[model samples]
Target: MASSRCTQKYAVGSPASSKASPLPSFHRFLTKVIQMNQLHTPKASRNQETGRLSFMAPVSPPRSGEAARGGLSRRNARRVKQSAPAFISSPCTFPTVLALKKIAFTVTSAALLSTFVVSPASAVDKDASANRPKPPAGMSRVGGELLGRTGTQVKLGVGAPVLPKDLTGRSWIVADAENGEVLAAHNPHWRLPPASTLKMLFADTVMPGLQPKTQTYTVQEKDLADLGEGSSLVGVKEHLSYTVHDLWLGVFLRSGNDAVHVLSSMYGGIPKTVADMQAHAEELQALDTKVVSPDGYDAPDQVSSAYDLTLFARSGLQKADFREYCSTAEADFPGAKKKNGKRETFKIQNTNRLLTGADGVDPYKGIAGVKNGYTTHAGNTFTGVAERNGKVLLVTVMNPSSKEPHAVYKEAADLLDWGFAASGKVTPVGELVPPRSASTGTGTGKGPAAAREEDKGKNGPSHNTEAVAAEGDGGGGGGVGIALGIAGGVLALLAGGVFLVNRRWPLPDLVRRLPRR
Candidate 1:
């Protein structure tokens, strides 16, 4: 019944001829039917009715701003309204059948074209990060675990697996001159005599700045006067002259105390030189270490921990020239000619047993030129770099007893073996609490009472609430807080996207308000 009424309301009719002009009223009714059909017929039949209207008379101009109100403000609405036959149709009474078919095809083609148009270009970033190489085995083991534990909420991955309990003794640490993250430490805070290993720091202060070939120093009366010295010495006579480079070879290779004093005095007066050594130590942030003598001699105040000694040795080895000097097993300082001066020649030997194959350390097998030091106070200290299968490991041992220097080596080997077994992998937890802005607060884990005392004492930076829980607090508020923050950030972003979609297109009301014509 509704369809019948629609057809009557939007009538379709044949055109009246001039021969029928005698019935002008009938002709008028026929004309009105054609106009109604042109205005209100279904879109599929409108083209034919449009042709009849065009043949009968000219088209009227559309109302100003009517098109804007009808649809163009919205993309989908504009598509529906623009394609309506009244908007673009040309009237032709004969061949209306063909026009209707053409209009149907045009509408179908427009919809399909919209679906198949090329999609917008998406942003694509090349992942150059994957090309980076893995860190060394020792790094994989130590820094991996520590960084993983601290930054796990970021979800990087778990750190290369390591037995943390196995990492307890033997004095371990993870330090980088770059980041300064001492990821793991054992007995790092303790101070002990550094023994001969202290020479590495002595070499660090001297080697880089020396014009080795040009600078020459004469052995002072006091420097060479002490004969039959129990400590390491490069025997030289009083008033004997040597180049700075030659003295460096002796101090580095033979662990020569005799040559160390000569270099120290030549670089600056003894007092100023010793101050520089202390200053260098401060620069490296090796606080527990104090150097009373340039050589790693047994002075009452000269002390360093295993960690600090490693830090000192690391600084020296980082220099290409320093490593060349220390790595040399033997060197011959040229003898003075009789015409030039009295002939004085000496063969300096490397003291590091690991390189010499002494005390069961075999460099051929693995160990590299690192210094060894021993004193009554410091039993035996060793630091060296070992390379195997493209993996380099740095090991430092402090005060292993005379009977147990090899045992320290064995333990280092074990760490290397275990470290390589775990590939370079680490998981970083996101910030437990967002890193407090330095502008707002210091992240010191101190309480208010402690902070007040620090402020009053004028010792250093004050303690603050930002201090995180102590290391090894397996389950703490910091850990829980970090996990929750990451989850919250992800959820919030998802909700925002959904809200934007709903705001852009509210469709249900538009469909319900479509008016019946």
Candidate 2:
């Protein structure tokens, strides 16, 4: 015999584009069940070949004319879209199989979801959480005890596959900049070499100190000594003069260590610059950061943590010039002269893959900047910020576990995707504590927005270009999580997905599927 009713097929769409998309479909199935009057009976039947119910529905009696007249209203009918009963008036009449089915479904889904949640929120049952991988002793990934106390911690989803895919970073944090909340993190306090990710802190400390961008400095031959072997350079030449403004560009866009040395020497010396940076870190309450070199080349006893790196980014983003330099995809870099009184110039590309979108990476929509770093010791580390719908998020990943160079950026993108999707939907797991308090003294820090009109006019477009393309968007949905409620039980599922697409060209598919960071 052939059954007459069954739920249609479900083809999952991209999670990011659809909002509460799955709920309606799942609900439709339940509506059929609750509305049953039991006057009509289910005819047990099977597909001729498959040997299964063609439509395994429990046929119910049609709504009585008197009952329909007694209850449904035009307004209520409109609200339900005529798809389901307005209320479950006969709970006792519901078949026992419904209960059995609901329980079985919940159990099956929970078992499947458990395989994915390796680092669930602390509130989850201990038996379910027992197998979770905790960081080794002395390692501090996602502070378990702190989460319960701070109440600022968040899990991306109940069971969303939104965890940074292919993440190899041993320590990382995703934070909401506007709320100053840590959405998700692991080993936040673990010490590691920061490589160039520390540059944001250096910039936050030094950019203001070099007040006169117009002031020119002739590079000293001795400044070249600061360049470490096997390190990145911005092609600075001894005896060539570079304005404080242009050198800052080199420091940001190219991750130029040589430019950092020149700036460090101008401030005082490497030793003084390092001391100032450390002092600034203390003021910011970035206790995990110890600055031995202003340029962040590997050195004995020099270290920083994911938490401190995010603090540095949060503080630095307040200055508009810092935003401008970091987001610039490409800009003209003036090179040394050949004695003809004319300077050569070439485009210096930002090494930050999140901004440039080259190197098999997708340019993060709304991505501005913070910094990225790599060294033999530090591996690849990145601290990044992105904005959407007025909510800005920061992601800092230190020392990717993958050997690939782009893994850090890719993992950083994944974390950012998860952060944006998790915003508002999940409660924070930890708080990004603000600086204890700043007592007013003669303040050296002047954010770019506060700079005089005359200064900005004099500096001009040749020095800085408009941001590539950051635009406004609407806020994301709230109360969303990986674990969805199926009736009274939990159905663990991915709540959001990778949303970015290359609007410009043929390689859009290549970008979406790119395995690199």
lDDT for each candidate structure: 0.44, 0.57
Query: Alpha carbon lDDT of residue 261, candidate 2?
Result: 93
lDDT of 2 by residue, 201-302 (tens): 899889888978889999999987857675567778899999988898888877888899999988888888999999988766676688998888888888
Worst 10 residues of 2 by lDDT: 43-52
Candidate 1 accuracy as lDDT: 0.44
Across 1-517, the per-residue lDDT of candidate 1 in tens digits comes to: 3223322332222232212222235335445543443343222100111111111110111122211111111223214222334533455443555443433434433342332222111100011122212211121111112222211111112444442232322243332222122323333434667767788888777666676545787777876543223566665446778888888877766666777777776777556667887887665545557888777767788887655666566556545566567666667864555776667675656665555554445543344566766554554566765445544445566543212335444444454454444324322211111111211122122222221221122222211111132233222111211111111112211332221101111122222322221
Listed in order, each prediction's TM-score against the native is 0.49, 0.57
Off by over 4 Å in 2: 1-153, 156-162, 403-405, 439-517
